[model samples]
Target: MALFRWGHSWDAFHDLEREVDRLLQSVNLSLSFQGLRFGRQYPPVNLYELPTEYLITAELPGVKSEELELTIANGVLSMTGRHISPEGAAEERFRRQERPRGVWQRSISLPDRVKSDNLSAEFVNGILKIHLPKADEVKPRQIPVAFGT
Candidate 1:
């Protein structure tokens, strides 16, 4: 009976460990200090790869295009900008502030080298979509298979 109890406890501990790992993977590793998430970037992003190009979509609800800066260097694409708060809210008291404000920079690594010159970006409906064309050498190709007798 004791051996069985120990085995159940060990399994429970492993399950808890896996749950913690999953939660950590989904959230940004940021330290909360003084009611502020320091060194944390707002607006989560999603990246997808199509047949010809790679698409990166980021959620930027209140950020304007004029305040955004996009750059790609060393195979990493970076988007940096500041979220403008209300013009005059210094004296206002907030009940619960969930939306992140202030300057943020998010960098994503690319799987392959892309054509930077032909890259296109569009911001519409609070979503920023960037289309990066894969280089010719990196694009997949199908070679004709010659079956010899």
Candidate 2:
């Protein structure tokens, strides 16, 4: 009777393991499909905001600066560009491919009101830097406060 019980328990444990493996496989498939669809769209970016101004830096290696487009409209800053992988490379086998290719657009919100006309962008060393000057009225100022007796 003890041997019979042990055999039944082992079978139940194996069944549970199989179910877990199926669930994990389904999740991985879903993620792969989503990544494929996203890669066809825009690439990812990193945005940084400071006290006096907003700074935006995007990674665009292997792409010319002229190929990028930066635009500011209605307080939104947009960076769009395309990074094409090198052709004729025989090593196509990829262990992991998280970096996105193709065309990508990234939009960032300013920390404070900014003068769109005064904005400037520079691309150097595979990094796109954008400097947004804050509006005069929105800049931080020290105000004197009178002590009440």
Candidate 3:
């Protein structure tokens, strides 16, 4: 009876493993599950709206300025960059790798209209900061009400 019980437990374990494999396949992230993905669209970002301008920041470590590009049009901002892998270590095996490499692009819509030509970008300590000035018509204005005499 003990041997039969062991066989049943093994079947249950195999069933669970097959279910997990099916789930991973359904999501189409089997490479992510196996840790073999070379480039992933990642690198978190932050966006903030100031009184007169919008501030955008992105974390892009180990990326060069020449490899990055930025574009703004029709209230939409786009950023593209390449995260190059390290040199001479391509043959080395990795036990655990999480950093994303290769080209990545991200586009975000601005909350308000912005003056695309009047913008500035700065990269400091692996952080890219962008300042986009709001359009004149989009800036808030105070309206005064006058009582009829």
lDDT of 3 by residue, 20-112 (tens): 655655666635623233233355667888888999988887777899999988878889988776776563566666677678888888888
Q: Where in model 3 is the C-alpha error above 4 Å?
A: 1-41, 93-96, 142-149
TM-score of each candidate? 0.68, 0.57, 0.66
Query: lDDT at 36 for candidate 2?
Result: 34
Model 2 ranges with Cα > 4 A deviation: 1-26, 29-43, 87-99, 141-149
Tell me the whole-model lDDT of each prediction, alpha carbons only.
Answer: 0.75, 0.65, 0.74
**How much does candidate 1 score in TM-score?**
0.68
Best by lDDT: 1
Better of 2 and 3 by lDDT: 3
Q: Is candidate 2 or candidate 3 better by TM-score?
A: 3
Q: Report clashes for each candidate as comma-separated counts.
A: 0, 1, 0
Q: For this target, which candidate reaches the highest TM-score against the unseen true structure?
A: 1
Worst 10 residues of 1 by lDDT: 1-10
